[model samples]
Target: MKTILAILAGATLALAATAAPAQTLKSVKDRGELLCGVSKGLQGFSAPDASGKWTGFDVDVCRALAAAIFNDPNKVSFVPLTADERFPALKDGKIDVLSRNSTWTLEREAKLGLLFTAINYYDGQGFLVRDARKVTSALELDKSKVCVQAGTTAESTTKDYFAANSMALELVTLPTSGDLVKAYEDGKCDTITTDVSQLYALRLTMAKPADHIVLPDVISKEPLGPVVRQGDDQWFNLVKWTIFAMINAEELGVATNTLDAAVKSQKPEVKRLVGTEGNYGEQLGVSNDFVVRIVKAVGNYGESFERNVGAASKLGIPRGINQLWSMGGILYAPPVR
Candidate 1:
């Protein structure tokens, strides 16, 4: 009888655990603003303008979520955080979402009690050296002093990469990206190593931007995206689908300029995407036209990318792997229906 009672107790506890609710959506709704954690100032990703208005690829993700929930892109509060403070702020509920330029790794999701929603940017680590160095590849970076942020994957990855290539590495660690940039500019390190996208962004901030060149060789795969505190499946789904919806919109050729025509499209995929055919958005705790609102306010993924980081912007970084699956790159999103 004791063994049977023990089995019943275990089953009851399991049910109770599964029954615990996710409060993120309700808490954000009640709070009247979606608090988002962003980088201190990564230009193409997340940064505030002179007027203190946040605008960039990562910032738009937060604004897209706000539009989906409240039909207002301005219903978000941007919290600028450093590399070390980002995860803790999200875990402590100080921010509803972390749209910082953080890479999604196994240890981060499994060990840090956080969930990476989706890969918003496909990036890889690379080296940036002075143009006068006449260096064309990463292999040319032997016996160099590299500048990198202290508390980042790039720090360990730099060591591993140099060790694997039989190159001697002298690391110059700084507390933040800004510090690392200053160190590199002040001739503290021979080379700067970080995500290629970051290298592009940081280089533009330098006094002599044209004097540096980013090497073509990429070392580590850095799949960067938005993150949320673990155990909130509802909030997770909301963020994941928001990005997917934008990608899908781009794949279907539903852009902001042609939004009205997209809504009137007779094709089934277009109909489903523009809310003329399905209740998909309702299932995710929003109205059927949630994607419409997102596209209207922030625009689809391609528009966001172009406006912030692509050829239209000062960064001029090509779409490359961030392009849709249909367009040579591997960025595949699920169907909205």
Candidate 2:
């Protein structure tokens, strides 16, 4: 009798622990909104318009997830935060996912206890300098004053590169991107260091974009993507595959305007994605129409990105590293079927 009681108790505890992963679906359904963390007005990335509506590449990630959950993309709350605050916000459950332009690093993954869903943008760090400086290479800026954000991975990366190369560069710490830009404009710093995408975004807003240029020096490979708190494999998988659905939609030629026609698509991939064939969404605690809702809400991965920050946008960034693998870039998604 004693042995049986002990065995039953152990089994019950094991089942209880195993069942915790299944609760996130119910909790999100009860909440009715996806809390999406974004940046504090990073132009093409995340910002509010005159109508006070948030729109950008990062914002689309949030809205897309909301569509997957409630079948309504607009059912989302955008929580804008700074670089220093975004990590803590996600970890504390203040936001469901960090959809900002956050880099995926082993230290952040293993040490900070965070998980990256996928690498949406294959980016790198670079330098932006005044055109009159006539300096094209990063190594040529020896002893040059450089303005960088006070606390960012970009700053540390810049320092490491300079130190390893035995180059003496003055590091001018700025509290924000705006401040760093101002310092560079005022010639307080001969150059400014940041991610190449951010450098272009900032340049587009400057009074004289022609007077400044970003060098062709990509110092580091920054695979940036969405982030969520550590633990809870089910929650992580939901965010991960939702992003995958968007990417896969683009690869399969599915879009918001073309979704109606796609329902009739006899293609195996399209059928699986549009809920005409598979039950993948059920595993993620969402309806079978989750991918359709996401595609219809925000088009596809390429559409959302290009509209916000691609060649047609003010940022004028080419889809060099972000293009699909078939297109000679690294963007790829696993098989949906």
Q: Clash totals for all models, in order? A: 0, 0
State, as a TM-score between 0 and 1, how close model 2 is to the true structure: 0.93
- Which is the leading candidate under lDDT? 1
Quality of model 2 by C-alpha lDDT: 0.86
Over the stretch 3-33, how does candidate 2's per-residue lDDT look in tens digits? 9999999999998886666355556778988
- Name every residue pair that clashes in candidate 2: none
Q: Among these predicted structures, which one has the highest TM-score?
A: 1
lDDT of 1 by residue, 1-337 (tens): 9999999999999998987767798998998999999999999889999998999999999999999999999999999999999999989889999999899999998889899999989999999999999999999888899999866899999999999989998999888889888999888998999999999999999999999999999999999999998888889999999999999989998888989999989999989988899898888888888889999998999999999999999999999999988889989998976
TM-score of each: 0.96, 0.93
C-alpha lDDT (0 to 100) for residue 76 of candidate 2: 86
| lDDT of candidate 2 at residue 48, scale 0 to 100 | 89
Model 2 spans with C-alpha error above 4 angstroms: 1-19
Poorest stretch of ten by lDDT in candidate 1 = 16-25
- The TM-score obtained by model 1 is 0.96
